[model samples]
Target chain A: MESPVDIQDLEIRLLLETMLHRYGYDFRNYTHASLKRRLLQCLAVCNITHISEAIPKIIHDRAFLDQLIYAMSVTVTECFRDPPFYRLLRERVIPLLATYPFINIWHAGCATGEEVYSMAILLQEEGLYNRVRIFATDINGKSLHQAKEGIYTIQNMEEYAQNYQESGGKASLPNYYHSKYDLARMHSSLKENIIFAAHNLATDNVFSETHLVMCRNVLIYFDQTLKNRALRLFDESLVHGGFLCLGTKESLSFSEISDRFTPVSQDLRIFQKKRGIR
Target chain B: MKSPHQRRAIVIGCSAGGLQALRTLLPELPPTYPLPILVVQHIPANSTGLHTTLLNHFCQLPILEANDKDPIRPGWVHFAPAGYHLLVEPNETIALSIDPKVNHSRPSIDLLFESAADVYQKGLIGVLLTGASQDGAQGLLKILHRGGITLVQDPKTAEAPLMPRFAIAIGAATKTLSLKEIGHTLKQLGADTRE
Candidate 1:
C-alpha cells in the first residue's frame, strides 16, 4: 500500500499540473517540500483537507488561486539586503556603467520595491539616475501595487536605515521617506526612472535588454532545472559584459552556462556575462 | 530508527538578528567536537557570504555554505545557502531542494528540521534560536514527535524572540536556555569534533 505521504505527494503533483494547464501559471518546477507546505497552507486557509477538494475549489475560483499564488510566491525582500554587495556595485560597477549613455537595469522579483528604491538611490547618488531605466517585476499583484505606491511600515525604517548606511548611502536614509500617520512614504522622485510590473520568471519571457540584472533571493525557490531555465533567460537578456547579481547563498557555479559568465565578486554572488558568449 | 540516545547529528534553525547570536554560540564550540552541525538561518538568497564569513571567523570547525548534493560530514558546519532548503537523506547525505518558500523563508528552519526528523528521527537534536518568524515551530514539533531533542533559545535573552517564544509556546522545545548557556550546552552535546 502506498503511504499517505506518498499519496499526498502525488496529489500535489496533479494539482500543480492542473493549475498550470488551467491558469497558465507555471509552478511545475518549484521545490517539492516548499510547494507542499504552500499547498497545505492554502488548503488549511480554504478550510479543506485534501487536494482533491481544494483543486476543484481553486479551479473555479480565480481569487482563491490568486491567494494561493501569493502564498506560494517568494516575496520577502529588503532594501540593500547585503550592504557590501551594493557597496561593491557603487564602488566598482557603477563607474564602468556610467560610461554608457543609456542603461537598462532589471530588478527581477522586486518584492514591494525596496531593492528597486535602493538601486534608484544608488543610481541617483552615482549620477546615473537620469540615464537609467529600471524594470522592476514580480508575479504578485499585491506586492507590485505596494511597490508602485512606494510606502512601507514605519517599523521597517530602522532596519532599512541601517542597511542604507551599510550600503554606503550618500544621504540620510530617512531623507528618502516621509512619515505620515504610522507609515513612511518613500519619495516620489525615486520612482521617476522605475517601472513596476507583474512578470513571472517561471512563465514570462524576456521583456528588455539590460546592463545589469539583480535577481537576488528569488532563484533559490526554484528546483535546479527551473534555475537553469531562468538563468538561460537571464543569459539571453543581458548584454555583453552586463552584470548579474544574486543572493549570497545563490551561485552560478553549477549552472550549464556557468562558463558564459565570469565572477565579479564570487563571495558576493555577483557575475558579469562574458563579452562574447552568444 | 535508532533511539534518541544513539542519535549522531544535530540540526539548528535560526533567523533575524542571528548573525551576532551565531557568533556568540558557534565560536565557543571546540574544533574537534564529535558530531556534524547543520544550520538553517533565514536570510536573503544572495547573502550566504555573510554567514559563511561570520562562521569562518568564529568557529574552528570547517564551515561551508552547502551546495546541491553535498554530502553531510563530521567536523564541518553546513549552512543552507540562502534561497534553498537543505535536507538530509536517510543515508545521512545532504540534498538541496528548490521548492517554494515556507514560513516566508527559503532556507527555512522548519524545512531542515522536518527533513532531519524524517531522516535521523530519534538520533537528531534540533535547536531553535533567535528569530523573528514562526518558521521553525512546526519542524521542531516534528523533531520532538520523532523523539529528537529540541532546544530553544530563551526568548528574554534572544535578539529576536518571536521564534523561540513560538517554539516554547507550542511545546516544541525540550529545553530553553540563554544564548550563552545554550552555547556551552551545545559544546557538551558534541558539535563537529569527530573527524
Candidate 2:
C-alpha cells in the first residue's frame, strides 16, 4: 500500500492533470507542497471527502470549479502594503516616470485591486494620474470582478490609513474612498484609468511596453521553473529602464533572469530593468 | 518509545511568546545537531525579517528565513517568513504559501506541522510551545496520529499556555517539558543521532 503522503501526491498530480486537460488551466508548474495544501483546503471547503472525489466535481461543475479556482489562487492583498516599498516607489520610481508623456503600468496578479488603487492614489498625488494607464490583471476572474468593484470592508480602513501615512501619503486615506455602513468603496476617480482583466501570468503573453510591473507576493508561490518563466515574461514586457517591484520575501538572486534587472532597492526588493548593458 | 536517533526532522510551532522562547531554545541545539529544524512562529504580515535576525544572533547553527525551493538540511534552522505558510516537501525542500491564513496567521502552526507530518511521518518530532491561540493543536494531533513524537511546552513554564494546553487536552503530546527540559531533550537527541 502506498503511504498517505504518496497517495496524496498521486491524487494531486491527477487533479492538476485533470485541471489542465479539462479546463486548459495549467497549475502543474505551481510549487507542489503549497499546491497540495491548497487542494486539500479546496477539498475541505467544497465538502468533498478526498482529492479523487473533488476532481470529478471540478470537471463537471463550472460553478464549483470557479470557487475552487478562487481558493487555489493567491488573492490576498491590501492597500499600500509594505509601506516602505510604496515609499520607495514614490521617492525614486515615480519621479522617473513623471518625465514620460504617457505612463503605462502593469500590476500583475493584482488581487482584489488594492495595489491598483494604491498606485492610482500615488500617481494622482504626484500630479501624473491624468497621463497614466494601468492594466491590473489576475488569473482568477472572480478576483478581477472584485478588483473592478473596488469595495472592501470598512474595518480595514484604519490599517490602510496607517499604511498610507507610512507610505508618505499627504492626504488622509479616507480622502480616496467613500464609506457607508460596513463597506468602503474607492472613489470612481481612482478607477478611471485602470483596466481590470483576467490574465493568467502562467499562460499569458508578455504585456509589452509597460513602464513598471508590480507583482508583489505572487512569485513566492511558484516553483523555480515557473518563477523563471514569469521573470522572463516581465523582462520581455518591460521597457528599458522600467521598474519591477517584488514582495520583501522574494529575490531575483536565484533567478535565471536576474541579470536582466539590477537592484534599485535591494532591501525592498525593487529592481530596475538593466538598460542595454546586460 | 523510539530513541531520539530514529527521528529524521524536528518541527516546532509557537505564536504569542515565540520569539523569546526561540532565543532561549535555539542556542541550545549545538552547531553539530544532526536533524533539520523547521519553525513556525506567528508574526505580522509586514514583518521585516527581524525575528530571524534576532534568532540567528544567538544560534550557533546557521539560521535562515525560509524561502521557496530552499533545501531542508541538517544543522540549520528555518523559520517561516511572515505572510506565508511554509511546508516541507517529501524531497526535503521548502515550499512557501500565500494561501489564506489559518488560525488568523499566515505562517500558521497548523499548516507547518501538518505538512511536516505528511513529509516526515513517523520520523518527525513535533514540539508545541508557548502561544496564546490553539493553532498547533490539530497539527500536533495529526503528527501523533502519524506515529511521530509530540512534545508540548509545560504550561507552567510557557508564557502563554493556551496552545500547549489545548494540545494536551487533545491528547496530542507524548511528553510535556519545560523550555529548559525541551532544549535538553533536543540536545540529547542530536547527540544520540550523531552516534
Candidate 3:
C-alpha cells in the first residue's frame, strides 16, 4: 500500500501539471515548499484541503487560477529597497552611459514600475532622459496597468522620498509627483521614455538590444536551469559592454558567464560586461 | 536515528564580493572530492554561466548548474542558479522554490541552510563565506538549531565582513576560519563519504 505522503506528492504533481496545461504558467519547476505553501493557501481560500478536491474547481474556474497567480506573484517591493545601490548608479553608471548617443535600458521584472520611474527621474536629473528608451516589463498584467497609470498612494511617497534622497537626489523628491487626495500622481514626462509591457522572463526570449539591464530581486524565484536560460537571453540582448545591475543581496559569482562581466561595485552588486574582451 | 558515520553534504552561500571569493574557494576543491557541494551564490536571472565555467576550470569533479528535480550526487558541485532557492529534500533530491525572497535574497543562504537543516539535520555542514549582506545569519542559526555543523569565513579575512559578522554575532557558527583553512577542512570532511 502506498503511504499517504506518497499519495500527496503524486496529487501535487498532478495539480501542477494540470495548471501548466490549462493555464500555461509553469510552476512545475518551483521549489516544493513554496509551491505547497501557495497551494495550501489556495485551498484554504477555496475552502478545501486535498489537491483532488481543488483540481476540478481550478480547472473549470478561471477566477480561481488568477487568484492563485496573484498569491504566487506577490513580491515585496518598496520604493528604493536598497538606496545605496541607486546612489552608486547615479555616481558611477550615469557618467559612462551618458557618453552614448542614444541608450536603451531594460528593467526586467519591473513590478508596479516604481524602479522605472526612479530610473527616469535619475536620468532626467542627469540630462539623459530625452535620449534614453526604457523598456519596463513584468509578467503580471495587473501590475503593468498600475505602472502605466503612474499613480501611487501618498502613504508610499514618504518612503519614496527617503529612498530618493538616499539615492542622491539633486532636488526635492516631491518635485516629481503631484499630490491630491493623499495620492501622488507622478510627472507625466517620466512615462514618456518608458514602455511598460508584459514579458515573462521564464519563457520570453530577448526583445531588444539593451545598454543597461536592471533585473533586481526577480531571479531568486527561478530554478538554476531557468536562471541559466534567462542569463543567456540577457547576454544575447545586451550590447557589447552593457551594464547589468542586480539587487544588493545578489551577485554574478556563480554564473557561467561571470568571466564575460566585470564587477563595477561588487559590494553593491553592480557589474559591467567586459568591453571588447567578450 | 544517529548513524554510525556522519552522512555529510556541503552547503555554501556567497553574495557581494562573492565572485572573487568563489574564484578563490571553488578552485581549491579537487574533482575527486567524494561529497556533494551545494551552493547559493546570489545572482540575477542572467548569470548561472559564471558558476559552471569557474568550477570547470578548478575542480576535477564534475560541476554543473542545478536543475529542478535533479538528484543530488557525490563528487559534484551543484549551484542554485539565479532566481530560485534550492532546497534539499529528505530523500536528498534537489527541490527548487520560488518562495518570496528570504533575508531579501532569492538564492538566499537562509533558504538553503534552513531546508538542509530539515532534510539532512546533523549530516549537513553549512558554510557562509564573503558577502555584503546579512542573509545567511538566520539560516545558519536554523542549521545549528537542528544540530548541523556551521562554518563562517573569519570576518577579518572575508572579502566582505557583513555576512560572516552577522553569523558570528548570532553565535550560529561552529568554526570561523580563513579561506585556506576552510578549503582544507572541506577536503577532509568531504573525503569521508559513506557511499
Candidate 4:
C-alpha cells in the first residue's frame, strides 16, 4: 500500500502539471525536495489541506496562481549574499569585463534584486557601471516589480552592510541608498543601466550575448535536466571568455555544457567560457 | 542475515555546544558501521566547518560536510553545511535548498528530520541531541509516526536541554537516554528493534 507521503507526492506532480498546462508557469522541473516543501508552505498560506485541492484553485483562480508562483519562487537572497563570490568577481572577473567598451551582465533569476544592486555597486566602484547594461530578469513578475522599485527593509540593511564590506566594497554600502523611516531606497543612479524583466529559465531563450552571467543560488532548485537547460542558456548567451557564476553549491560537473567552461574559481563557483571547445 | 530493525539510514540534529556533544557522541560507532548518517547541527552561517574535522579525529566513520547531489554512502557521516538546509531526496541523493528558514534557522533540524522520515520511513533512525531551540521535536514525531526509531538525549545529560526536552514532552522519543547510552543505542540499533 502506498503511504500518505507518496500519495501527496503524486498530488504535487498533478498540481505542477495543471499549472504548467493551464498558465504555462513551469514548476514541473523544480527539484522535488525543495519544491515539495514550498508547495506545502503555499498550501498552508492558502489555508488548504491537501496538495490535490491546489489543482482546482490553480486552474480557476488566476490571481491565486500568480500568488503561488510568487510564493514558491521567492528564493530568500541577500545583498552580496555569498561575500566570497562578490569578492572573487571584483578581484578576478571585473578586470576581464573592463576590456569591453560596452558590457552586458545578466542576472538570471534576479529575484528581489539584492544581488543585482550588489553588482551595480561593485561596477560603480570598479568604474564600469556607466558602460555596463545589466539585464536582471526573473520568472516572477512580482519580484521583477520589486527589483525595479529597489526598496528594501532597513532592518535587512545592516546585515547587507556587513556583506558589502566583506565583499570588499570601496565605499560604505549605505552611501548607495537613502533611508526613509523603515525602508531603504536605492539611489536612482544605480537603476540607470539596469533592465528588470520577466525571463523564464524554463522557457526563455537568450537574445543578447552577455559578458558576465550571475545566476547564483538559482539553479539549485532545478532538477538536473532543467539545470542543464538553464546552464546551456547561460552558456549560449555568454560571449567568448565571458564569466558564469553559479551558486556556491552548484557545479557544472556532469552538466551538458560542462566542457565549454573552465573553472576560474571553482570554490567560488565562478567559471570562464573557453574561447573554443577543443 | 536480516538486520533487526531493517534500518537504512540515520539522521542526527543538535545545536548550541553541539561540537562537544557530538565529539563524545560519535566515537561509539565502530569503523564498519553499516548505514549512512546525516546530521544537522545548528552553527553560524559563516562556520568554518571545524566540527567535521574535530569529530573525524575520534569518529570511526568518516565525517564530511554534505554536498549537493552527492549520493548517500554507507559508513560516512555527512554534516549539513552552514547556510543551507540539507535534505535526502527520495532517490537517496543529498539535495540542498536556500528556502526560507524553519524555526528561524536556515539549517533547521525539523526540516532534515521530516524529509529524512519521508524518504527512509521505517528504515530510518533519528537522534535528537542538545539544542537551544524547539526545531527538531516535530520532525522527531514525524519519524516516530513513520515507524522509525526515535532517540532523544536525556535532557539532564544535554548541554542545552530545551530541544530534547521538547521532544520528550511531545511523546516523540521511543528512547530517552543519556548521551553515552544514546551513543551505545545507536551503535547497536538494528540488533533488537525488529518489526
Error of 4 at B157 (Å): 1.2
Candidates by lDDT, descending order: 4, 2, 1, 3
What does DockQ give for each predicted structure? Answer: 0.14, 0.63, 0.10, 0.67
Model 4: per-residue Cα lDDT over B1-195, one tens digit each: 436757898999999878888889888888878788999999889987888888889888999987677789888999899999998888888888888788988898998999899999889999999989999999999999998889999999888999999999999999999989988887777335423
Badly placed stretches (over 4 Å) of model 2 are: B1-6
Candidate 3, residues B53-153, lDDT tens digits: the string is 86677667787777655779987888887767788865577766555677788877887887777667678889999899999898899878877788899
Which candidate number would show the highest DockQ if scored against the true structure? 4
Q: What tens-digit string does per-residue lDDT give for candidate 1 at A1-278?
A: 76555677678888888789899889988766556666787789778888877788678999988888888885667788779999999998999899889999999889888899999989998889998999999998888988999998988887788888988999998888999987998898999889999898888999999999999877766777788988988888899989999877677867878999988899788899999656
Among these predictions, the greatest TM-score belongs to 4
Model 2 scores what on Cα lDDT?
0.88
Angstrom error of the Cα, residue B76, model 3: value is: 18
Docking class of 4: medium
- TM-score per candidate, chains pooled: 0.76, 0.94, 0.64, 0.96
What is the alpha-carbon lDDT of model 3 when measured against the actual structure?
0.80
Q: Model 4, range A1-278, lDDT digits (tens) per residue?
A: 88888899899889988998998888888878788888888889889999899888889999999999988888888899989988989999999899999999999999999999999999999999999999999999998999899999999997799999998999998999999999999999999999998999998799789999999888878888898899999998999999999988888988899899999998888999999664
Task: State each model's C-alpha RMSD to the native.
Answer: 5.9, 2.0, 9.2, 2.1
Clashing residue pairs in all predictions, respectively, total 14, 0, 23, 0
| Candidate number that wins on DockQ, 1 or 4 | 4
What is the per-residue lDDT of model 1 for residues B1-195, given as tens digits with 9 covering 90 to 100? 333246578898889888888888888878777778899988886563677886797788888888654568876899888767887755566666555587889877888998788667677888899999999999999999977888899999998999999999989988999878887877766632232
Model 3: how far residue B146 lies from native, Å: 12
| Tens-digit lDDT track of model 2 for A44-137 | 8767877888888878998987887887885678899889999999999999989889998989999888989999999999999999999999
